[model samples]
Target: MADKLDHLLSDYFRGKLDVAIQLRQMELTYRHGTPDENIGGGRKQNDYNNVVESRMIHEQNDPELKRLRYQKSVIKMMFDCLIKSHQDVLIDKYGNKKGWVTIGMDNHIDERTARE
Candidate 1:
């Protein structure tokens, strides 16, 4: 479980920039409308066809973006509950991608304690 959480945190850290870029692109696409080549040709007609509904559907259907958002939120919630020292340790280890020895030294704790 710890290893899984660590992996998730690592992915969250690495995907932050990607998430931001994707969100910006989504916003721009919504604002300016999708390009002609990107639009699909379908003959199905639905009464629920509206810009707001389309945007909501587009966002909701994007699984990768949704997963990234969830991972980001989970990390944020975990961070919010931790003490300052623990938060710093997490940031040093995951956010800064520092080694255990370096993190321990920076925090004035031994390597084992830092790992813990």
Candidate 2:
């Protein structure tokens, strides 16, 4: 169970940067506009139909974004609940990709303890 938690935390540390980047790109798309889908001669729909379709599409939730945000929040909540020393050890081992020896030395604990 400990190993599984460690692996999950390590993956979370690695993926957080990627998640931030993707979310930023999404934000930029919303800020600037999404690319024009109706380039050249496309279907000639009426203005009312176009407006209704756009509203429906925009109003729908994105499942991927929702999952990402939920995962981030849950991970953050778990991280926040740990004691400071354990948090430091986790950050060094997973976030910094440091070895157990180095983490033990930094925290002044036994190498085996740090690994555990």
Give model 1 RMSD, 1 decimal.
5.7
> What TM-score against the true fold does each predicted structure earn?
0.65, 0.59
Best by lDDT: 1
The sequence of per-residue lDDT tens digits that candidate 1 reaches over residues 1-116 is 98988877776666664666487548735666544463567644653547777777767777766776776777779779999999888888878899999999999999999999
Report the alpha-carbon TM-score of model 1 versus the true structure.
0.65
Any residue pairs clashing in model 2, and if so which? none
Best by TM-score: 1
Per-residue lDDT of model 2, residues 2-94, tens digit only: 897677677788786466647754663465445557776877565353654653464345565555566677988988999999999988988
Model 2 CA deviation exceeding 4 Å by range? 1-8, 11-21, 24-60
